[model samples]
Target: MAEETADDYLKVIVFQLKEEEYAMEVDYIQSIERMQPITRIPGVESFIVGVMNLRGVITPVIDLRKRFNIESMEYNEATRILVLNKDNSEIGFIVDGANDVMDIPASKIEPTPEVVGGVAEEYLRGVVKLEDRLFTLLHIDKVLNKNNEEKRTVV
Candidate 1:
């Protein structure tokens, strides 16, 4: 086997939530789109706003702020839907906006620090130290995992 380079491990798509910048792996991102009409589901969790018809397929819409326990903000022109695929399930995350795609070398990435609060530590894949700032890379699997577990326990 050959040694892995910094390019071999990390891939990211940056976006905004509550005006703060964040990113997740490009592999987990299915699509991004403008906000659309969503059908609210009664009795669902607060984070789960509702579902949307995406070219005839229904996809659940989640308020990323609520999911991460961040303060909610009103949607603006920059608002977008980040569709994520996890464990064969599709979930659409509503974010403040979408930013550019960044390829951070694995060497530049560090384990998520314990200082970041509200956003669960398990939800973070790592932190990428850029030229002047740090970008938190979210672990979609762990974030979605918690939601799936909640659903199972409720049933």
Candidate 2:
């Protein structure tokens, strides 16, 4: 008989923030591209950089660093925007740089620990231990929910 293996898997899109690595489900990501000009929206949340014309569609961009309360860094060669879709709404997330796509098996993923720095427990989905390194998986829905709630309260 063949040994049964856990099929727990996630299609993740990895990216960099500061010197750490993070990832989110690919299904939530619509597109990825280099940083472009943005139109600032007055009175909007500071985390919200502005809106961008994405192939004729105006999409709001969020600076993930600010959203997470991390110190902001200037855009560089590795900077890119990760377009995400949630609840039928498209939102763009600015990331430091994008890495390769990785399929993480279920066994490799574990519940996030409490000691991870610069990351809130609510925003984390899980921790994937790959080789000797750890990758933080983000819960996009939770993050977006918090953003939407803040927007509503402000309006």
Candidate 3:
């Protein structure tokens, strides 16, 4: 008979970038979409891949590869856009591919070490180990705030 803490479990959306696995809490993810045409907007950081029109809304897309300084790869059939909601704004994160949603128990989650997957320490919420796999839980807010250049009027 063990007490259940609020941190006992977390549902995460796992994705791959530069061959490394990463996770973001499912609560923040609005939706997952296939690769879409992106309209490039200049004067922004390289990580900012520009924006795309989703239905009638304009959403900004970010390349996690570029954001984490990881090696870039061509977008193909496996590419995916993870729509995330922060506050009242919605943004898209372009990942190499999204695997699946997983429930990670708190016991398996550990605070981030020195570095995980070359991504900035500040951008990592923590790390977890499950089934011989190391999953880096990302802090999407910090990732998106890295440049904050994407915060603009979307029409």
Candidate 4:
């Protein structure tokens, strides 16, 4: 066993999902964009909302609520799409609304519990406790890699 160092402090972009707080590593995020018109594509997973032209790039967007089997809600003014880079492929995840960036030290993040919220436990890195708030840390790779392939994809 080794002592956690300064590198253990995880910088995360926190957001709201079904009224609960969730977070993902800032390193994997590209940018947070406002909800934009998504061109629907048929024959894909239900969670796959559609693709959008981000600047000159075509990016696929997924509704995190639908992906996690959480109750769907109307996209409001605060709704946002989190741009993510994995390997060379870029994707987007629509969340309830993005909040703030917070750094949670390793000791503050607890291991995934049997049932955290709507998302499957396996897709979670852990949960963070800060004062009266709790933010579930999302494992972006696991959430996007449906096949669980070992191949590393760099964004």
Candidate 5:
């Protein structure tokens, strides 16, 4: 039998955005929540939808659609907020939906192609294939750092 290192497989949380599926490693995720009321903030990037209280901790939320330059869609029952811890604070990303947690063998992960629709290349960590479905693995740091926007003061 072969040895299994921590890098042998990637455990990820799969989510949907538009018609494509995306994945983010579970290690970075804090929680996944159903759609909730968001209090809009003034003078922030258009992609930064607003902020919402997550169990009494005010967390800033950003619409991944807008962040990826994809057209906006109305929030429905399927929408979700993926909360993550960043710099001792919490931030959330609004996604179309999050529906899977799976382990994709590292062998199945490929370097991102030159052109993948919906999200920009910099935001992608790689492409993963599990059976017949493909998942775009997102580089969460790059996704949130694109604009180098100042971190908002969480109340």
Candidate 6:
């Protein structure tokens, strides 16, 4: 019934990557899935866990823990794969879990400070503070660019 200004608010999908929470614009997300068998690929970046079949599509999966250089952990019932469509290609990020879809007002987002814990600044767009909780909003372009540019595959 009313116009929604893109700059006035953001709709993000929040997910856990260790103890901290991270978010990405829901526009980029295709689906959230339970952990599935990822067939290993050789010679790609260590963070790129492998590929998995989603229905009929073979999607590459990246382990967020490994990507952020976080300590490795076992994938339990809580583990999830965040499938995202970038440049018409689907890629999945394996995270601790994905739980919420929240709408955050633009005024609540702050530019990332000089120093922040976990995940690199290059991969971050900004930080969102909602009440007492903080969420690191991901820079999907930068996060997905490396994978797209490299297009690495080795036998």
Poorest 10 consecutive residues by lDDT, candidate 3: 144-153
Q: State, as a TM-score between 0 and 1, how close model 1 is to the true structure.
A: 0.86
lDDT of 3 by residue, 1-155 (tens): 79767779899999998768999999999999999999999998788899999888899998988988888888999999999888988899999899989988888889999845478788888899999899899987788786533456879
lDDT of each: 0.83, 0.86, 0.88, 0.90, 0.90, 0.89
Model 3 lDDT at residue 147: 59
lDDT for 102 (candidate 2): 84
- Give Cα distance to truth, residue 69, candidate 3, Å: 0.3
Q: How would you encode candidate 1's per-residue C-alpha lDDT over 4-92 as one tens digit per residue? A: 78667677889987656788888888899899999999998888999999878799999989888899988888899999877777889
- Clashing residue pairs in candidate 2 are 8-106
lDDT of 6 by residue, 30-92 (tens): 999999999999999889999999999999999989887789999999999999999899999
**Could you tell me the TM-score of candidate 5?**
0.90
- Candidate no. 2 TM-score: 0.88
- In candidate 1, clashing pairs total 0
lDDT of 2 at 64: 91
lDDT of 3: 0.88
Between prediction 1 and prediction 4, which has the larger TM-score? 4
Cα lDDT over the full model 6:
0.89
Task: State the lDDT at 113 in candidate 1.
Answer: 89
What local lDDT score does residue 70 receive in model 1, on the 0 to 100 scale?
93
